[model samples]
Target chain A: MTDGQETIKSSIWFEEAEADNPYAAASCYCSGYDVYGDLLGKVSWVQYLYLLFKLDLPDPQHARLLETLAVALANPGIRDHSVRAAMNAGVAGSTKASALMAAVAVGAGNLGGGREVYLCLDLWHHLGSDMEKWQHAISQPSQDERIDVWLPMEHFPGFDPNGVTCPRPVVQTLALLADIGSYQPLIWLRDHRSELEAATGYPLSMAGVAAAAFHALGFSSEQAEMLYLLLRLPGAAAHALEQEQHGWRQYPFFGTALKPMADADYQSLMKTTEAK
Target chain B: MMESTRNSLAYFDNHWPTNKGAWFPGEAVRYREMSLFDDFRDKSWMDLLIYGIRGTMPQPEVSRLMEQIWIICTSYPDPRLWNNRVAALAGTTRSTGALALGVATAVSEASIYGRRPDIIGCEFLISTCDQVAAGGELDVIVMEYLKKHRSIPGFGRPIISRDERIEPLLAVARELELDRGDHLALVKRIEDVLDRKRMRMKANISSYCAALLADLGFSPREFYNTVLLSFTGGIMPCYLDAVEKPEGVFFPLSCSKIQYQGAGIRRLENVKK
Candidate 1:
């Protein structure tokens, strides 16, 4: 028993010291999980996976990895089978990750969650350009001429170039993270800003704040992705809890039910109310 | 019939217009009487009886019978006091202006409520902003107002604008052909006014949309209500975003003069000694 304990302790100590253990990296990633959890909850797991790969894990344990994957899948209410397929495909590196991410994006519908993620990326893309110059370009006398130049400053008025959430805590976090020498997340933010912005109308600064906080706390891409799932899970949990507590079973066909009204019913209600 | 009466009572409770002494005594009396009937029909007789009997009734004899039979059902949480407070708080000239806009626009635009005109307008404005921001030369006047601390009307810090969804409604107006030309004219006129004033006060999307709804023959009241509904979509998301990403923690008391003055007094005493 003593020998077994000693061996286990040595293995644990060795893994901690190795700096390349994926599980250790993941644990490190989890520490800063709260940063973008809220925003990420609104995004697709596939995008989260993309970010995870960017975090550069060493050798992640199978169980820990699966737990992270399960959290992401279950949080969004994605079917278990689909999640398993995606996980398998993701491991195989068959661009199935992108397909899964796209599925999550489609599921988001027009609720503006996925779009917000894209907006964050867009804002991050133009962090270093002069704000005044961008403003000037957008406000130039020749409106037609100004349209040709896709300057970030001109495009996003009253937004900070470097500050996440524009003059908020995200900038501070980014500085702190940069000071600690974790440059990969910030670099990704800078590179993906445009595409994300075009996809989501929200500013990059908003998303960057969360990304910066996670990066500062040493979260790998996978952990960051998981953090987003965790953040969004609370909202869904709250809704579900509320539904359960209230015994609020939705009956769509019943006009008096607490469910959302159909267009015709809504119109009739409005008409009746107006007449009154 | 009873349900209609109840609904009418609820509606009155939610949206009873305040008395500004604009009507004659007879008119006021008639309005109050009408309200009583509406309330009586809406609430159950038992509910009314219980409320009337509460001992705090202003006049004992009058209150006794009133308390036993009359119940006032208010849409507000607390009818007697809260409704008055809300009314008092809402008694601003700006609210009157909003009322006036609603009335005038309603007379002009009759079809504002068809198929969620406000939502349609919002979608258009969003699409336009995207197109213009991408490469099209769509005139964005609010971008200028953001410069001067005075907001660009519909684009920033919403509460002051109240009817921020007007621009999108105007986009809807373009489709309905109710008052599209007039709506566009209003937008152009606002631009002209801003240019003349040199203050950069461009007409925001809200005003434009409101004008369009007016053109579509929606009553100003309906137009305002639709605008509120449309803007609620933006407001809800923004609130969620704000909650998820709080800007900063503000310490109101810490920054108060009491703390500073208290410290200064100690410093002064030390200097005297």
Candidate 2:
């Protein structure tokens, strides 16, 4: 190449002819796909999801566990933050898509939502690999007591010692499935329930259990929350639809009555503060 | 519910520790044993609201008026029944100030400006205060703003016929012997003119804050920032309340309870093509 042409090329751009790609289309070569063309027609959606997330197809047992876990967490009910947000949006005459987005926004802020789940998953991975950190976490007081400071990844209260409404069918089913699949995390949670409870004042939370399962399954921390959002979307949509059909502008909870500020009280309160 | 001393302490305790972790990182590190509003010992709410406005604090009367105004703002909508109750619930519709603000703040700087009507109202009032301070007539300035916008900022509120805070704020301002500042005088004059004109507008809490900020020589931006900082502590109790609920489910509803209005199910293939 001419010096002038080479200079222009170098200054403008450098072509990446041998750049590696993590995804591919219309080709046999792809992550864990000997034949992408065949897998497209043959693989189940759940199997494909597993491959996409794990970068490898799951065995039958692992596939069932992952599928069941997703199903169990899918639509927790109208009480769920995301579901109620969606329904409220729908009641306010928002479009279906807007309602769903509203629901996602609310859900994304909860303790089990994307941010907290990501934290819990991160802690799970950290605690799994590091014994010292695990020891510290177990020794810490219940999350409620130490409101002064908090780490995002803390509070996997699988069983809140103070009473947790663990959806009975789902939790029991997951535990049973975990046994059949021989997943160590689920088994560990089941076997060491009392010990873990003793270590941390709160029992293992639903999200904590899910985090442990995700960690054991080799899913990354970031993937854990995205996976949750995706699973919960349909549930939120269902609530939005229901709200559109039967709900009103307001929820059941009556609003707080505003106290008219009595002049006497205002004076007294001011005087009290001044006196203090 | 009557806010007992214990409940008040709980409200303060819930917010102070979590403030550093959740939102405002600028708060000084606080341990468990420290009292609520501990950082502002002997400092009244007015002092905190206008912290950076002037090197010297306002006259003692201004301080007292500001204190009364703060009390009026904080006293209403009981914290236990509202902030720590219904309004702060996670699924609370956008009707609640906290939920709406929560969503608005989530958007980056590109979208934060328009969500806060109180801030907008304060900004407009601050600008008007500038002109009045520059010797502009309150009637002419207000008329010009009303001609363009059909409503005056810092006056009138939705969901209520009268603002409860105005009279108490004025009473407190008068009691404190600081009722005659230029901004305050102009605001009262505007209220009188509006009343005579049959325009049902009354000064609200923002009006009081804006007057105090302007009298203290705060720039419009400083007024906005300072007022928001003052009230940001209020939203924390709602958040703490919501999180304490089971699964953090606030103000829950059963699916069958919802009323649907959309079109019934229609098959895609059944439609004429």
Best by DockQ: 2
How is the predicted docking of candidate 2 categorized under the CAPRI scheme? incorrect
Candidate 2 per-residue C-alpha lDDT over B1-273 given as tens digits, one digit per residue, 9 for 90 to 100: 122423654554423322111111233222122222454577665654454344344455666655565466543433333333443554343244545345433331121121143445556666677787788887787777788778765687655757676777777766766666777666777888788778888877776767765666665455555444333344455555545555534534332222333233222221111
Clashes of each: 34, 18
Q: lDDT of model 2 at residue B15? A: 34
Q: lDDT per residue, candidate 1, B64-111, as tens digits?
A: 322221121111122112222222222322223222222222222222
Q: Which candidate tops TM-score?
A: 2
Alpha carbon deviation, residue B188, candidate 2 (Å): 45
Q: What TM-score should be assigned to candidate 1? A: 0.23
Write candidate 1's Cα lDDT for A137-191 as tens digits.
3345123211100112222332322222223343443344344343565544454
Give the per-residue Cα lDDT of candidate 2 at B273: 10
- Deviation from truth (RMSD, Å), model 2: 21.3
Distance from true position, residue B249, model 2, in Å?
42
Show model 2 residue runs off by greater than 4 Å: A1-37, A129-135, A141-170, A256-276, B1-273
Tell me, by lDDT, which candidate is best.
2
